[model samples]
Target: MGQAAPSKDEVARRLADIGPGEEREIGEGVFMTMHRLQAIQPLGDGWHRAQSTEGSFSVELPLPFNDFRVRAQATDNVEMRTHTVGGKTPGLLAWSASCLARRDGKLGPEARAPGSDKIEVKGTPPVAHSRSVDLDDMTCILIVEAQGSDPVPPEADRLRFLHSLKRTGRPAW
Candidate 1:
């Protein structure tokens, strides 16, 4: 017989323990690879696969950071934001949409709210990367912020998470 697959809880613990500069699988065919930045430590607390309660879509997130910082009138459009935790810069503000066509411009007010100040990361200030992604039936908007001189999380990390957004085999109609 083959070895049994790891449970979800076990996967979460392993992802946390692996820290930065390492890759951990958060779900079936879903893997999160942490990138290292100067002066920043690795992240912990693992990742959880977050799905809309209505089963419209699914994505991955680091623990304790799943709260939506901003949301539209329609609950399907939302943005999950967080501060730096466990030594790792929390560079993720992932948005999910049930209908990309109907909700493209209705997500994250913070993303729409404009102006950004330069923040230091690895001793040098870099502008935060705010980007949008389209995943077939879902839409993802990613935002990474740098408060004052604090370092912004890497864009690669945000992209990784954004790309992981997938529809959960449910019709959005």
Candidate 2:
């Protein structure tokens, strides 16, 4: 027999209690780790920095903020890391992106141009902005979705979030 899944409240509780550098196993072969920024500078009022150590990138988000390094191991040595923030906060947008590194550490394909799309949700139409940055050995694909309200987030907010994304360096793992 298998164990019952956690309730929504329980899941929320766990996520709320997670602190910097703490890691939790949310699924089989998938791990989530909260990150701590080495240095935090004030971008503005009511915003915080979210960094992914494994992905080696950082972005800024509004208050009531947190970021997680989600690792899904496919095999003994193959894994992918996705960095995310603000998925559960009402009235606030969410950001989910991933960085992929070539094992050979060579320059890959040219980075794609930044673009935007409209996604239909239950209550409103969310806007999705996507961009890619090519590093020495990796490509970071960033996609941020603004939704959960009629007007969605302001265009300035979306641009700020997207423009704040920075590649710290190559992935550590």
- Model 2 residue runs over 4 Å out of place are 1-16, 36-41, 45-49, 75-77, 85-89, 100-126
TM-score of 1: 0.35
Tell me, what's the RMSD of every candidate?
A: 15.3, 5.8
Residue-wise C-alpha lDDT for candidate 2, range 59-154, written one tens digit per residue = 776544455577764333545566654332465455555666534344333333333223223333546666666555555666666555524467
Q: What's each prediction's TM-score?
A: 0.35, 0.60
Candidate 2: deviation at residue 160, Å? 2.6
Model 1 ranges with Cα > 4 A deviation: 1-45, 67-125, 135-138, 147-150, 171-173
Candidate 1 residues 75-102, lDDT tens each? Answer: 4444321111112234433222222322
lDDT of each: 0.40, 0.59
**For all candidates, what are the clash counts?**
0, 0
